[model samples]
Target: MSSSAAGRPDDPVAALAELTEAQRQQAMRRWRLLRPHLEDGVAITRLAAATDASPRTLHRWLTAYRNDGLAGLARRPRADKGRRHFPADLRLLIEGLALREPRASIATVARQAAAVARDQGWPIPSYATVYDIVRRIDPAMATLALDGEKRYRDVFDLVHRRQAERPNQIWQADHTQLDLWVITPAGRPARPWLTVIQDDHSRAIAGYAVNLGAPTALTTALTLRQAIWRKSDPGWHVCGIPEIFHVDHGSDFTSLHLEQVMADLRIRPVFSLPGRPRGRGKVERIFGTVNQMCLSQLPGYAPRGTRDRAGRAQLTLAELDTAIGTFIRTIYNHSPHGETGVPPQQRWESASFIPRMPDSLEQLDLLLLTIAKPRKIHPDGIHFQGLRYLDPILAAYVGDSVVIRYDPRDMAEIRIFHTGHFLCRAICPDLANHTISLKDITAARNARRRDLRAQLRDRASVVDRLIEAHQVPDPMPLPPPAAPAEAPPVRRLKRYREE
Candidate 1:
C-alpha cells in the first residue's frame, strides 16, 4: 500500500500530503513509537519518551484519535491570523482624553468619548471598556479615583493631630475689614480695618486694633506690646507666653520691625503659605463669621468700593478707628462663637493664658517701636503720608535720622519725639481740606447740589402748606435799586427818549 494508505485500519492515513515535510517526519516517528505500545497497552509516558514528546502531546493525540479516529491528529488548517484579545483603538482614545483633562472623572471622560464616537459614526465602547483600558495604560490613574477628596481628608487629619488642648500653645493672628461706619469730620461715611490675635485653644482674642489704614508693622507690634503688658500686670495676675504665633503673609506680619519685636519677645512667628488659605483657616473663618454675622448687619454698611468712591466719600479715618474699638470690645470678645459655645473672654479667663505684663506704658512703647525708614521733614514741617508735624526736639536732629511714632487710627494728631522727649503734637487737616489740590471738589459740589435741591423742595412744600391753611401771603422781597454813579465829566448825558 501507498504511504498515505498504509496506516492502522482504525486510523487510516488522512491528509498526510498537506503536512510540511518536517511535520510529516515527526508524525511518522510518533506513529512508529505508538504502534508497539498499542499492542501491549503501553504507558502513555513511555510512548511520549520514545517519540521525543511531552505527555500533553500524547494526550492531545489520544483525544484526536477518539474524535476523528486519525484525521484530527493531522495538523489543523493553519490559522489565518493571530488572536487579538486587547482592544487597541479604544485604549488610545481613553488615554488621549485622560491626557487632555487630567482632573476629569473617568465616567465623565468615558461619556465624552462615547459622544464623540457616535458623532463620528465610529464604534462606541462601554464605560467598563474605557475603565479597563485606563487601568492597563496607567495604574496610578486607577489609584487616584478622586482629586480633592484626598487633600480634604488630609487636612482634617492634620487638624485633629495639631489641635492644642492648652490656650497658650497656639495663637492665630490676622487682619480683617470691619463694617462699622463712622461719619467723617466732613460728614462722609467711613469704615475701619481691624487686626486681631486670638488664642487657638481658648478662642480668646489676645490683642486687637482698629486703625484708620490697614494695620502696619508698628500697629501690630504696639497691639502685641499692649496685650503682653496687660497679661503681665499685677492687677490682672495673668502670665503665659504662647509657643506658636501664626499669621498670614501680610506686609505687617513680615516686616522687619515686627520680626525684631517677635525676636526680642522670644516668640516664634510662623507664616502661612501664600495662596493657601487653609494654613490660616482658623483666622480666615473667624473673619468670615464676623463679616456675615456682625458686619453685614450694620447700618450704612457698604461693600468696598474703588479708590475714587472712597476718596469722594471723604472716609473718616479717626471715627472709624473708635467704632472698630467698640466692635471688638463690645461685640467680638463678648459674643459667643457657635463652634466654641463660649464667649472669647470667658474662654480666655478659663484657660488662664495671660502673659507677664510690662512695668510701664513707656517701656511697652519702646519695646514695640522698631527701626523704620527715616524720612526727612519737608519745608511744610510734615514728615510722611501728608502728616503735618512739628517737633521742638526734632529741631536739633533736623538733618539727622530720628524715630517717629504715632497711632494709625488718630492720624489727625501725631506725637513727635526726639530721643524719647515729648517734642511736639501736630493736628491733621480738616477732612474737607485734607487733600492738597482740592481733589475733593467733586464731593463738595455734589453735596452743595443735593443741599440746594432739598432746600428748594422744602420751600415749595411750605408754600403749599401756607396756601392750604389760608395764611397771609408773604410778598417776595425785591432787590434795592442800585445807587447812580457820578457822571464822567458830563460825557454820558445822551437821552434816547428825547431824541
Candidate 2:
C-alpha cells in the first residue's frame, strides 16, 4: 500500500468515489475503544489501563476522532466537503439565551429559539443542535442552568469569588414552620414556629428557638444570645462580631430590637431586598432542604390548623420542639452541604479568619441589646399591640420619654425602667389583635378551660372503662344494705350483753 493509502489517503476524488476504502481505519479503531468507556459503569482508569494509554490522551483522541472521523483525524482533506463549523448567528443566539435566561432548560431555550426563528423567518435549530452550539461556544455557560435556580444578584455577588473563610464572618438566619405539633406547658396545642441562625462558614446552627406563634425580635434575640454563648468560651472577649448578619426582611429581623442587638454586638445586620430570597440564598436553600428532607418526612406531622381543613392529627408543642432540636443539631448541621462540599461543623472549625470575641459580659450585653422604640400610651393606659405597660418607677416620667426593654413576643408587658428604677407591670388583652383595653380574656380563659376539659375527659373515660371491665354496679345498693344491717344487729347484741 502506498504511504497516502496507509496514512493520509491522498486521492480526494477517488477517496470520495470509493467511500469506506479510502478513509483512515486507525481513527475508527480509536473511537470504538473510547465510546464504550464513556458509559455509566465503565471506569476511565480501567479503560486506560486496558488500552495502555493515559486517561487524558484517550479522552483527547476520543473527542477528536468522534467529531471528525478517520479522514479528518488523519489530517487529510475530504473530497466533497469543506471544514465543519457552527453558523455564527446560531452560536450568538445560543449564547444570548444562556445569558438572558439562566434558569431556562435546554429544551425550553431551543423552543424559544425556534419560535424566534419562525417569527423572524430564519432557519431554526433543534434543541440538540442548540445544545451543541452552546457547548462549542462556551461549555461553562451550559452548566449555568444546572445550578437549580438563579440566586439573588447581591448574594451571588458576595459568594461568587470567595468561600466562607471563618465562623461569625457571615451568619444566615431564617424562619421555618416546623412539622411537629406541640402541646404547650399550659396544655394548649402550639404550632411552634422555628427560627434558626446558621453560621455560613461552619454550617453550624448557632442558635434556634421554637415559639407558639410567628418569630419575634425577642425570640430572635434570645436565640442569638444562646448561640453566641455556645460558640464563645467563658472568658473569650466578644468584641468584633460577625461582619455580616444576613437575613430576609421579615418583621422580626427588621424590628428595632433586632437592629439594636446586632449594633450592640458590633455585628452588621444585612437585609435582603423585599421579595428577593436570593439575597439570603444560603438560608433559603437550607429552608428548602429542611422542609423537604426533614419536616415533611416526619411522621404524625400536621399542617397548621388554619391551613388544614381536614383536622388531621397534630404533634403537640413539646413534641415538635424536641423534633426540631434533634433535626437542627443532629441532622441539618452535621449533614454535608451540596455547595460547600463539607459538613457545617467542619467548615466552622476550619474558618480561621473570623473576628475576635468581645472582652466582658457587660460589653457583650451592651453589644447585643438595643434601645426599645417609643410609643405613646393610649387612653386605656396601653401601648402598641395592646400591651398595657405601667411603671411605678416611670410615674414621674409617665407621658414622658422612658426607655422600655421588651421582648417582641410579649408586647402585652413592657419592661419599663427610667433612671434605673423598676416599674409596675401592666397586662394587655391580646397583642395579636392589637386591642389594648378590649381585654378579650375570653379566648385565653376558654383555651385554658378547653385544655382542662380535655384532660378531665381523658381521665373520666379511662375510669369508666375500668368500672365497666370490673362489672361494678352503679350504687352497689342491695349488697351495701345487707352489710349495714348485719353490722347494726351485731353491735346491738354486744351492747345488750354488756348491760
**RMSD list, candidates in order:** 27.2, 29.8
Please give the lDDT score for candidate 1.
0.61
Model 1: per-residue lDDT, tens digit, 1-499? 1233333444345455556777676666555655554556678888777677788887777665445444445666558543224445555667777656356677987998898778767778778777766666543443344334454443433442246687667777787766556555656655667777777876766766666566788778766765565543232322345677787788888888777766756689878666444455666677666666655555455555523234434336654454545565667767787778898676767855445444567655654545643556543455667556643333334455445666654566555555556556544554223433333434544565677799999999999998999966769978999999897775666779785
CA deviation > 4 Å runs, candidate 1: 1-112, 115-123, 126-161, 178-192, 211-215, 229-241, 277-279, 301-342, 352-354, 367-499
Clashing pairs in 1: 232-356, 232-357, 240-354, 412-428
| Worst lDDT 10-window in candidate 1 | 1-10
Per-candidate clash tally: 4, 18
Could you tell me the TM-score of candidate 1?
A: 0.48
